[model samples]
Target: MRAELFDPRTEAVPAEWDKFLRDEGAPAAWDAGALAAVAWTSLRTVLLGVVADGGQAVALFCGDFGSPRRRNPVYSPVGGPGRPGVYFSRILMGFDEGFLFATHLDHAGRVAARRAFERALKARLGRRCLGVVYQNVSAAALPVMRTAARLCRPVSPNTVLVNRWQSMEEYFAGLPRDRRRRLRRTYADVDADSGLRVGAGVPAVDPVEAARLEQLTRLKHLSPGEVLVPLPSLYFERLNHRDGVRYFVHTDPATGALLSFDLSFEHAAGLVTTVTGSAAGAATGRGLYWDLYLREIEYAIERGVPRLEFGKGLVELKARFGCVTVPQYAVAAPL
Candidate 1:
């Protein structure tokens, strides 16, 4: 019943922050509109509230992180311990030095929510610079965050586990039709090539310019970086300033030129392509990225959107339309 600091004029704290990250069960990007659009994780919009206590309601919530080159070993500011969901991605600044990435929190004992999140990170950054804050694993979360990161002791902490697909055509009819016929002959040879007019839109989304931030850093070398641009291009122009999101582009009507793109979000089934890009040298057609991913999966089934996640890696051209292969995990514990 302590810790506090959240305040964006605080009114609709997303129904108490999406019921405290869904009762802290841990996913859906830690609910409440992904902690209100991550704003480059300034300790999650400068939050610090942990409030609720005794009766329970207070597992954790912290803030005040840094980046004066985070001890300067290479560099990776790409968002903080990655929050907005399940849990475990520590930096408690005390001897516990936590970590529990990709955690589902394997069921067992809570151990008092692991000593109250390491006693609120050793009472806010103390006790021997407690670093590494990563824990939990998710095949759909709940193992009590791997028994509260082994009761906050010290060993085992490199985590990753948060990718699934229980439905969605059993995860796309489980592919292999010649990798779904080379992903439908690379988008039907980029849609029977004609001036390459493929379709889908959500570009310039929250983006300012520099040609859409160099076309999303050149679509991060498409698949070479394995879908990851999570927010930059000015956080997708700050989710295009409140509109939040939606991404699927492939234009070129005789010269408008834009070829291909994808970066969805309105999830639950229908808007979740995550990241995509293609051009086929701008016109000729080398499979215009499978005709902009089967016209963004037939525009996610004409918007009914019962399914269209396609988040993790390529998985043989997203299992060539039939699209299957659900096993999302990406651990990283060590602070």
Candidate 2:
């Protein structure tokens, strides 16, 4: 198989390409539609392509926006996943921005896929820079990456998710009764506070006020502190998109101070919870952690997203919400 490049808007990348990746357990972030949506931004690029025998389905090495040539500690930017064999120019920074399919080749294909990735990458943007992500990685892609002859920065800061469930309810029922009871209690405990009332959805948005964003930002780290990290203002501005992604916010009624914010994407498998933040809402006993994560479960039910995937592997707390593990993989090589 080999990799190729074409505009999704103008060219046909092949349905089989998608079918192959999806069949391999690729997540929502990997959808061609998602790739095109990302292309809506100015920085998107089309590098190279990876194709198998008879031009069947294969993976993509997609990317977008280059980091500033001059680095800023504040901007911890990464690349995007896109059409196979796509490449972003050196006009960007340290990030080797583009889609190189050889990344995260299925484990069975990793050894060969790694060779394909290196060849594909060499064809487009000759080895330069560093920093990239193997979106929705799988074990297949790992082997090639482990042996890639490139300057790759290993970043596993986020966790992977897996779903080994017949039913979401059954998954929940699987949790220890005491843990389930505690989760239930936390939901009630937070609501009991008189001065602050808790609610969900987009009905309440006060992003202009740093306190609200701050609450969520902190909860992202599961931390409670005045310790604030500056975030891309665009994150909040883009939050108002209202067209593609669905957001569920937990807010304080009286003061309108945001307690938490969760963002989920409607993927083929289910509604994948990509990013979540919390102020712990009201300083209740269990704090921002839900007693039973009932709200998350309720939100998933409301959306009818059958399998709810909490980002992979912060198991201790997220597992209580009945999220099973889903692991992703990545691969890379030098020019």
Best by TM-score: 2
TM-score of 2: 0.54
Candidate 2 at 292: error in angstroms?
8.9
lDDT of 1 by residue, 229-297 (tens): 244354444444233256666565777555556655553423544444444354224655555565656
Residues 1-335 of candidate 2 have per-residue lDDT tens digits of 66554544446766665666655654434455544433443333433244564565545555442332222212222233322332332111111223334334456564555456556555444333333444444453455455545434443333323444454465456669987676656666666856455444442245444234544555555434323434333344444443335555655677766566655555455655554555543333336545224655665565555555565445766656655554543444324
Q: Whole-model lDDT, candidate 2?
A: 0.47
Q: Give all TM-scores, in the order shown.
A: 0.30, 0.54
- RMSD (Cα, Å) of candidate 2? 8.4
